[model samples]
Target: MSNLLSGETSPYLLQHAGQPVHWFPWGPAALERARRDDRPILLSIGYSACHWCHVMAHESFDDEATAALMNRLFVNIKVDREERPDLDQIYQTAHQLLTRQGGGWPLTVFLAPDGTPFHSGTYYPPEARHGRPAWRDLLESVAAAWQSQRGAIDQQGEAVRQALARTTPQATASEPAAVLAALGGPLQAVAGAWLAQRHDREHGGFGGAPKFPHATDLAWLLERGVAEGDGDARDIALLTLTRMAQGGLQDQLGGGFFRYSVDERWQIPHFEKMLSDNGLLLGLYAEATALTGDPLHGRAVEDGAGWLMREMQAPEGGYLSSLDADVEGREGRHYVWTSEEVRAALTPLEWDLASAHWDLIAAPNFEARHWHLGVVRPTAQLAATFDQPQAAIDEIITTVRAKLLARREQRLPPGRDDKVLTSWNALAITGMVRAAGLAGRPDWLQSARRAADFIHDHLWIEHQGRHRLLATWKDGQARFDAYLDDHAFLIEAMLALLQADFRLEDLRFAQALADELLDGFEDTAQGGFFFTRHDHERLIHRTKTGRDQALPSGNASAAWALQRLGHLVSEPRYLRAAERTLLLFAAEVAHQPGAWSRLLQAAVEQQCPPALIVLRGPQAREWRDALLQRCLPHTLVLAPPDATTGLPAPLDHPLPAAGGTTAWVCSGTQCLPPVHRLDELLAGLAPAPAPPTGR
Candidate 1:
């Protein structure tokens, strides 16, 4: 009854193990079988958390008659997009080119034995509806076309390959200084103005319905606001953060954010909570809190961090991937509530506060029968209406939330994808470390350290006399060669961890990972890193892009991390690679600066390097923590423990004066005089006075 997927580790693949379609996990055997049998390959790519993936599996993959047709005509191969992003990237592009439409999960493709796709679609219905072909009918038609039009299909596949090759950005040849100048100053201003133009001034996020949190872009705006003294940019980012915190997109009862809002008002969300999204948001809100000292941003960071620690983190240390959008057979069933249920869970006073605050007294907002809570009234307004203090109103609301959350916990919850992905965990570790520094949460820092330790112990391995990383670890097994994201994000995490709590082993690990990035993933001739490693199995196309998708661009992250590390240890090779990456993508970024937020950040840093501070002696951590209390977006502070020894050249500063802490500050390669006092160090690092305006 079980298919080839039964032996797979991915939860998404395992879900299809018992289907009647006899699914084969993506591998050489399936391709060989397809070639030997002279049948097309039915490639189905989706993740565990995809609702449509489940729907399609139930309606089509599980049907005996449909399975029989598929078994007879094609070699059905199932793929977890999260696990094999290489395959997903190649085919998703092919799907878009073939259909002239964007791609989504549950991606279905018909490919030749050589692995070129001829046809593709997403989520076909069992019976024809909504102007789409029925699943079985489509299958038979595709099979017939495969037999009758083999030559035409092969020709189209070649065209598709050529088009994909064209998608890769051609390397630009420019001097490093010229590249920096082109991507600097006026370019930043233009990009900021562009972002301002597209900003949804009335509703908060950028452009219309289905609003995503674009955490990287918001971070860019926040950084620009601080570094360049751009008030409008700062306010735009702050307003968006505030709206998302108050909106239904964030779970008001619990603490995490949903995948995205389905409406312009941020009132309805897709309901799945992903680690990658929350990780980026955690650091973003933490930075906002440090910048403005806004309690709203602080609370958002606290709540989001709490949700991650409480619900998502595994006992093994690494965080899980995502929470499913559907509960049982219905979407958002676990999170939505009826008015009766709310009233039953709370006392009268609490009910009054909750109902007013969450707008339960009005018509149901969800399906006309249930309510998805959103902040409709401020606590101050509720307090005034009740003739009570704001503190008293807040207490009542908090009590009501606790009771409701407890009751909701009794309901069947959405399924969780428990795979521990190296890249995602790295993102979370970086978030936790930064949030810990900002919020002074030692527990969060320890949580981050545990995850880092898990990755180092489990996923990191020595291969062919060099250290390498595995992408996913699940069911006590780590498999698949690590991609660029895995190395870049983890290296960044290590840097953040070192700033928070110095660890010699972590520094060493970061260096090893960086080496792996250069040796395995980097394009020495072209400059940017490829998505796949040099020795990775040959796919239709190898992606080397600078655009930010759901996650930040790997090339951008790599360049940023390498530059920071290079300056920290005075490594020219690392610095040169970073410069080359910026030069390679400089033209593409200049043409559409707003679209490349992450890369633009790397460019900004490339133009003006971040301040690097080295502290030595007894009070080092004390001074570092003091500086961390204030928002220093462009500074890196490291305070090696008193016992730390065998330091790198740049970190090996002279011992402290009179056994007290001494801070050595540097901008790029130039170091300022060492300061013995914290106040003096802070004063030395203060922002330069702005030039006087014309009288």
Candidate 2:
């Protein structure tokens, strides 16, 4: 018989439905049962894509004997970390404090009846091994302690509650001028230098093994490099992107990036492809391409976007959450290949080029039997060795990849989590919009629009006579109160979409999302947004953070979108919320600026507000696309078509100059006179030449 999780919509929870363990999905019923039975709650938190989660499930949850012991000792609760990040966040912090180590998936925490955690761990084996206690032994000990050592457990639980409460940063109030002063004086340069200190010069990403694509950090460095003429920062960002593109972390045969690399050299990845990671990386690579005009970055953007459209997008328009790491109980099975398989799939000429280009002739890279492809030899080098022209070599590489991808498709693929998350899809929309602008792909822009519309039509609703958003949608049902990220990211996505292809409805949708962000999630007193809405179910702790994690911070993204929207529509309310957020987090940011890259971006805008340009007329979009061909990270350009009507203030410029496109440019509150000629407008928007240095 299936457990309580069988009724849940989350793919992760449903995956555990058939386990022998009596699992209760996180809810009031589970907590009540724990309290009634006087039992500790064994909260198991993980996502569907986590490989270790699968391993632990097979080892213990599927074992009938283990399940019986767990049922007798505790009220076993299973939580999809992605679905309940609030619970995960609180417990993960408690785990860190209790264990004095970083936490990972399959988080095992023993919580008191009232929901305070006193002990925690991650991924225990059924049998004692690797210096870890066996699952059965651990459960028995904890049960015995609950009965005999009640006093000690209660004391520790109270202490943990205190620590979890302290995790929220205290608001540091300051005037706007003081906040700007705190951010002044080459802040990006300082942060870039700090980040550069940790850079792995040889491997091309920060630090060592288990490297993730820190897309936010790299984007900031690239912005500094291009906008401030910081060559060192620029080089660091470019080299990392180039290396990641050529590494096994990126799927060379198919497209899209894996979750992260397991090794420092990026030779092998965990193999799960996440929408959040790929979305952010897509926009990053597009910006990189715009900065250097390199075909390498362009190709990365194309392939990555292709993967999103082909594999992740739902027929209804929203993108799915993730592709699982394991297929048929074997990790990396679908992605790795033997040299014999490759040779058989290709002709002599194709095999010769592919072998050298992908290092197929090298020793087995995966478990001593197969290879995960990486670009060990460049196409130019392959051309020189093969005595073929560069174009011919490129064609051969393309043909070989197509053939391999087709063969790989014949294999059973990874399981997909088909739930549509609002925040992740918003990130994807923004990425797709930015990429479409750079690559001049109208189809991509349409894809973004479809997603935006999907969110609007389904996830967005009028509740209690007020506009609000739903966090996740699955099986034609939208559930859960939307968090700060959903509203903020959708606002940012709408803004990006408007810039790429202006629509009055999109602008209004963005405005509504911004308002909802302020109304539902903003901490009016603390001056930052909370991860959960104000009316969300009370948890032990409410997360108000600015640090960028796997995804960008909701607070930071809120500030960014609000500030830009405020400037565009001339609204001081939105602007003040953003300024207040910066002032609140200014001190923590000062101490560890590298950790808060997205917030620093908002701070940068606060110090030097982005230039806002409005184009009006039939050819407005044409002019907008022209200006966007190059990277202009600091400019917010909107081109409302001539037939568009009912635009809000500041956007409602006078009729086009003599039926031709007209541009209205402004910096902060000051506006430059309108320019009718495209050439003249371009000249006006161009950055002034730097003042000559003293000899």
Candidate 3:
């Protein structure tokens, strides 16, 4: 029989609706039942694409005896972590505090009736293995402890609460310029060295075994490369980008990247593809291509963006969340291919080149002697090996790849989590806008606009005279007050979208979102923004952090976007809030630059604000597009509508009043001489000038 999760919108939740376990979707009802019966709450948190989540479910949740024990001993509650990041964040942190280890998906927590977690761990096996307790035995022990030693569990819960309270950074207020000057040079040196130490120089990516694309770290390094002229920083970023593009993290038959590689060599991936990961990495590739002019980076951007449009986009335009790592209850079933399969799919000439170029002749890279493809040699090298022209070799490889992809499509595809998230879609919009502006692709720009329109129509909301945003939308329904990430990321996206194709409505929406962000998420007393909104449901703890993880932290994104938006809109409140946030996180950021990658990016911006270039008159688009082609990391291009007036004072320049198309480059209302020609504009922007004085 279906449980309460059957009515939920999250695909992760619905996947287990028919499980033997009596699952309760997190709500007042579950809390009430636990409190009424004085029973512990067995809270299980995971997402649709989480492979280990599936493993645990099949082993334990599907077993009738285990389900009966879980139902009898506790008020069972299952949460889709993607949908309830609030609960996930709190419990994940608590799990670490209790166990002194990192927490991951399928996080199992034993909580008291009042939602205080006393014990937690991730992914217990059905039977004892990996030096971990068996699931049923663990459950019985927890239940016994709850009944016999209630006071000890309550004390442990209280201790966790105290630890959580102490997690917030100590409040500090420092001048942005002074902080940047004192710490900026040292941080760049330390961060570069830290990344160098972790970098597998022989192969790409960081450390050994499991490898995640540390997009934030690469982005910060690239920013330093541009600002400080650090060649080594640029080299690191470029090499990582190139290796990841050629590695198995990329879908060799199709497009887009899998989540992360299991080996340090980047030869094997975990197989799940997340929208957030691709969106952030796409922007990285686009920017890297612009900086290095590497055709390989450009190709990566094209393939990744193509994957998004082809497989991830919903009919309504917003991008879907993820593609599961498994198909037919087996990991990599849809992606791996045998030697015979590849030979059958390609021509003789094609197979000869492809087998050598793609390492198909190497020992099997996957279980059961199947292969997950990885680039084995350069195209030129392959061409020479086969005594064929490079162009001919390229054509053969392309033709063979298309055939393989077509045959792969005939297999059962991975499950897709189709729910559209506002923050993730905002990231996607930024990626598309960056790629479109760089390549001058109107189609990509339109795709970005369509997604933005969907967000504005469905997610942007006004409730009780307060403008707000909903975090997730699916099946024509939008719900939940948006988190700080949602508002901050959308504001950032709107700015990028405006630069791609100037739109009056997008600018207006950005202003509204920024205002709402300041009012709802900013901590007036503490300075930094909270993860949850001011009116969000109260949890065990409210968090405000600036550290970058798999995704950039919400607080860091808010501060960064607000700083840029403030300069463009000339809003002192936004600027003040941003400055306060920088000061709030300054101590930690200064000491640990590696962990604070996104915040470091924001601090750099605070120290040296981007040149706000406003264009006007007949050839504004032409001027903007020309400037975009060049790598200008710290310049914002805007061509506001002619009808728009009474604009922000920082943007109230004489260029709009001047005759013909003209560009005015300014740093906070101090304008350089207006240039009417593209050549003059280029010359003026070629050198990175010193920052303007006295605000």
Best by lDDT: 1
* Candidate 1, 1-695: lDDT as tens digits: 23698899999998888888878888888889889989999999999889899899988998899999889888999999998988998898899999999999899999999899999999999999998899999999999999999999989999999999998877765676876887866678888888899898877888888899988889899988887889999989988998898889999888989989999889999888999999999999998887776666777899899999999889999999999999887888998999999999888878888999999999998984999998888787887898998778877887887899999999998999999999999999999999998778899999998899999999998888767799999989999999999999999999999999998988998998999999999888888899999999988889888888889999999999999998887788898999888888888877877667787888877878889899998888888887776667678999988778888888888786578888888888788888889888877655422232210
Greater TM-score among 1 and 3 belongs to 1
lDDT of 3: 0.85
The TM-score, computed over Cα atoms with residue i paired to residue i, of candidate 3 is: 0.96
Model 2: per-residue lDDT, tens digit, 454-529? 9999999789988789989998989887888888888999999989988888888888888888887888887888
List ranges where model 1 is wrong by over 4 Å.
684-695
lDDT for each candidate structure: 0.88, 0.87, 0.85
Worst 10 residues of 2 by lDDT: 686-695
Question: Candidate 3 — number of clashing residue pairs?
Answer: 0
Candidate 2 achieves a global lDDT of: 0.87
Measured with C-alpha atoms, the lDDT of residue 358 in candidate 3 is 80
